[model samples]
Target: METITTFGPLTPAAEIAAAFPSSVQGKNIIVTGVSPNSLGLATADAFACQSPANLIVTGRSYDKVEASITSLRSKYPNIQYHALIMDLASQSSVRDAAAKINQDDKIPTIDILVNNAGVMAIPALTLSEDGIETTFATNHLGHFLFTNLILPKIIKAAQRSSTPTRIINVTSFGHQFSPVRFSDINFSKRAADLPTAERPDLEKTEFFTGSSHAEDTYYGFFSYAQSKTANILFSVALNQRLWAQYGIASFAVHPGAVGTNINRHATPSEIEQALKRAAELGFDAASKTPEQGANSSVLAAVDPGLSLVDVAADEVTGVYIADCRVDDANVARFATNGHLAEKLWSLSEGLVQQKFE
Candidate 1:
């Protein structure tokens, strides 16, 4: 398929900012995870300049949400701003937030939704209140619900006004590890039997001690990889559903490693230092500033030429993108093994059947 050679890794956000069409002048856009202190804030800032009809920013914490809104308002005094508190780990919160956004009086339609929030490697396994794994809960399931909930409003608005609605799932390249384990998602039974650190002395040591699952056996990196891969698979599946019917195109993006605070989930210092060293060497594992990381997400959300892709297309959808461009290798793998993607989608759906169905 034909591709844009201009899009490249380490592509500056300013380049993306330059590509945004002037047509978004009065459009309604909602960006999740845009707390004042996060990379989402940079994304909101970039989009804020385009003067959308309404800009709604969200975060898991109320304080961060308010702070982000306050900062944006001061920076862009004339731009429309709205802020909401949401924790993606909780299904009820996702449902409530979507409902509230759909019902807002000023916002007659929803144009673009960006799912940019994510968590990294957590040493210990934990579950959300809804009883799903924390990593899977926050990274994939929450955004899935948010998109579906607001889809109708977005589609209706798009239909009435001829405005295209876009859903961008922010993903990562680290999703190359173990595919989804459909059988055991929550690790409920496993978590229950695991010995806590408080138990100092170990009497019978036939296997792993602190964590029931050995680090080598069930690497934290593998769990993270599974979640990120789910993000991509969800986007591909979602794109097929929405693009054919509603003309609402969905895309997944792996914002090349950026030096951000997405690593707040009990990651080891050794891993942290490794990331730092890799960043210095200009590897795919590196992190850019918050602004740089937010660029691709904004592009996927607002760029008008998204739906145009061919099978031979380089850097295309239903594939993984890194450094602001698509990876050819991932595309080929996905095209061949669609079952993996299908299985992940089904497994995720099963886990959250209560909230979504």
Candidate 2:
């Protein structure tokens, strides 16, 4: 594996694949939330061009998954593509998808798993079929269960391969908006009423909770932020538990701001307001093309420069990648808290009624 000296925020995914072709060649990669114009599709397309053994794409809709795979097959005819219908909000759906992958004869091992599917800023407080908050369930818990269920395959791939098997959680810079509200994860309690310790940043609380803190004041972005924070924590705990023992490296990636349908739940006015808040936090909030947005994830998945050995040796809090490089300054302190990561891992296990060792 070769290393690149520099990669900018606007670096193209193709350039990453070209830089480390061996990292992707003959590897089995799975990317969730892939549709025609989604960031997941862009990531998959990058891997496809590099001659991966299998490019498995997943989404909630069969039509969308089929369309994405069809388009990719047309352009990269030599590559193999598999479509799995997975509704990340539903635990049952995630289980079925993972089971299929494990039972499928063609998918012997999973070299890369990109937990890229997610919903953002859902305007209302919706619940999944399992009765958990929709945003949290879809963005964090769903991927949690799915990844754990598929651990066998990922570990198997790592055992046979020289390069580490990678798991990329597509998180966001929006994680700065809020930490995981452990006490009020579902936001059943008012953010203002939570203990001061629970609400670490009062200003951020006011931003997401609003001044009123009314009972019905459900801030969609707050829930989205909490889930994104969970994504990073999950990666932290995952890497800690699996890196040295199983040769698996996990990364949380902020794929810049890409124009995609993840915001379909938000109205134009809401989007405008969110942008204003983002600017206040000193974030660029500039939009990138799907291809460019996929760069960070592509880099996290294949860049030989990243070392799980170093992460394990240092016992670093967590690894958060942005703009195709390790950029921890942008991550919220709570997102990288090792204790929080362990707590989240336990909570996730209890919620899913299963444990991954």
Candidate 3:
């Protein structure tokens, strides 16, 4: 297999797609959060450039999804495009969307599943309809359930294809902001109130934990970070459970900072604060275009070079990818913890009220 040794942060998605045409051509691909000018649409466009048999793009709004599909149709007239309305914050919507995809004759299997839709830095301590923290619910739980519900399709695809079926969870380097608050995931308890041993180190600092009061302790960016951490842990657990038995490989990707609406919920000061912290950690803190952000995901989705590695021996399952290659230095230790991964899997199963082996 040829290696993508030269791929980097600035590499275009089309160039990466061109490297492994066989991995994407004639395959079924699905990307979430595909509104205009978003990373999801960019990823879909990348796959379309490779002649995928069916490209499914999903979003919370019908009109937006249709608009995305229309855009793809205009740009890639020969590729078949489908639209799905999936509000990841709602489990019912996710289930409905999954059923529709499963029953659709056109989408026999899902070759690549990109859990790309996410909300960042929600200004308030809002809860989803399911009563879970809004960011956690939408970013992690929703994709957790949706992916499991569609696993059969992915498994079927794995069985038919020689290469491993891929699941790319779009996480952010902001995962460095915090780990999963297992004891107080809803932010109902302040750091000071928690048992000294159980309190997270970051929460001890006001910079990470915004408010001193339990009721007002919800910092939007920290909550978003927790959910992003869950995305990586979920990928770990999914790969650990399915790789040996099903040939399904999962990856967590940090799609470099891109100027997109995912930041709409944050105030200018909040954005500045986040970037300041990122720079303090020695991160580049530089922004990329939507197409550049999509490159990491595109590589994780179809890069044949990844398939040649020994997942178990190399501990490749749930490996984090950045700038189109495996890069774990930026990931928090907790995000890659196997025990936390399993614990998260159980918690997710209980939350969704569905169990998967």
Candidate 4:
């Protein structure tokens, strides 16, 4: 089991970025889902500035991928940044992406793998080609498969590098919604948490395609929350496996409620109301730019100070960290019960089947 301390309410991302250390300057790092833009893109951009040996940024849209390459090149003309197109929701696309990375001659290994790409709150019961729910497929399963396929390379890099390699998963605090439903993940036999009318307004927005037909169609929010929880569980299980053997650790981060393309999936009315609420709360989503939202991720992945933690004497493995601190309450169950994490991982592994090794 892993044990970690909770560091809540981190300084704003912008404030942190101003004085942030550039630790990934010579490392080989990969940040996926950087095309559409958001905190993830900002995070990728931040890493580019560090001048890594190879910065592989990926996204689904070819045009967006091209645009990201163009933008990054203009800003950091000398950095070696490569952009690839891949659909994480599809197992085939993820496999092909990993295969291409494995075959690359430019670099022998990857020092950091930031699983920063994700979707949010779409009110539809969509399915991947493999027939799994879209949210579950992209947000959790895709990263799960991606990480394992590249584990050997990551391990090798850690062995050769000065600092240990790490995995920083970009997730949301909304994971508090519900525990992972080990018995039925697809919600095939269960009712959704939010009602149709109460769900985010998808009718007025043309954001990403949802998993169901309507807000109440199945409970997109509930599904989203559940998938995020699964993400935390995955982190717990992943850290448990890697910490002892590889000296590699994992972390989960919530980008602190920034307004991004995620609203593209919500109804226009919902978007308006959300923005209005943000205004009323004096909570500036703009306060933490994507670059800043990605600060903790940057710190977690490459910061040397973070390496001083006593991994051998203390059981800090597989703990959820937000805003640059440990969050055990957020993951107490998995920390205390390896069986539950193993159970969930086994169930998900079975569902993904051939997609995994």
Task: For each candidate in the order shown, give its overall lDDT on alpha carbons.
Answer: 0.67, 0.85, 0.83, 0.67
Across 259-280, the per-residue lDDT of candidate 2 in tens digits comes to 8989898777666666677778
**Which lDDT tens digits does candidate 1 get at residues 237-332?**
665556667777766777766666776654456456546554555565655777778777767766665544322232234345555555556533
Model 4 agreement with the true structure over 237-332: per-residue lDDT tens digits: 777678777778777766766667765676776545545554665544344556557767766676544533223323334356555655455543
For residue 12, model 2's alpha carbon misses the true position, in angstroms, by 1.3
- Sort all candidates by lDDT, best to worst: 2, 3, 1, 4
Candidate number of the best lDDT: 2
Candidate 3 Cα misplacement greater than 4 A, ranges: 1-3, 195-216, 307-318
As for model 3, its CA RMSD to the true structure in angstroms is: 2.8
In terms of lDDT, model 3 sits at 0.83
Q: What ranking emerges by TM-score with the best candidate at the front?
A: 2, 3, 1, 4
lDDT of residue 42 for candidate 2: 93
Please give, for residues 1-357, the per-residue lDDT of candidate 3 as tens digits. 234556988888878888889889999999999998899988888989889999999999899889988888888899988888999999999999999998998899999999999999888889999889999999999999999998999999999998548999999887876778887878887656666533444642345334323334777777888899999988888878888888888889999889899989888776676566667868767888899999989888887667432335323333788887777666777788788888889989999999897
Q: After superposition, how far is residue 189 of candidate 3 from its true place, in Å?
A: 0.9
lDDT for model 2: 0.85
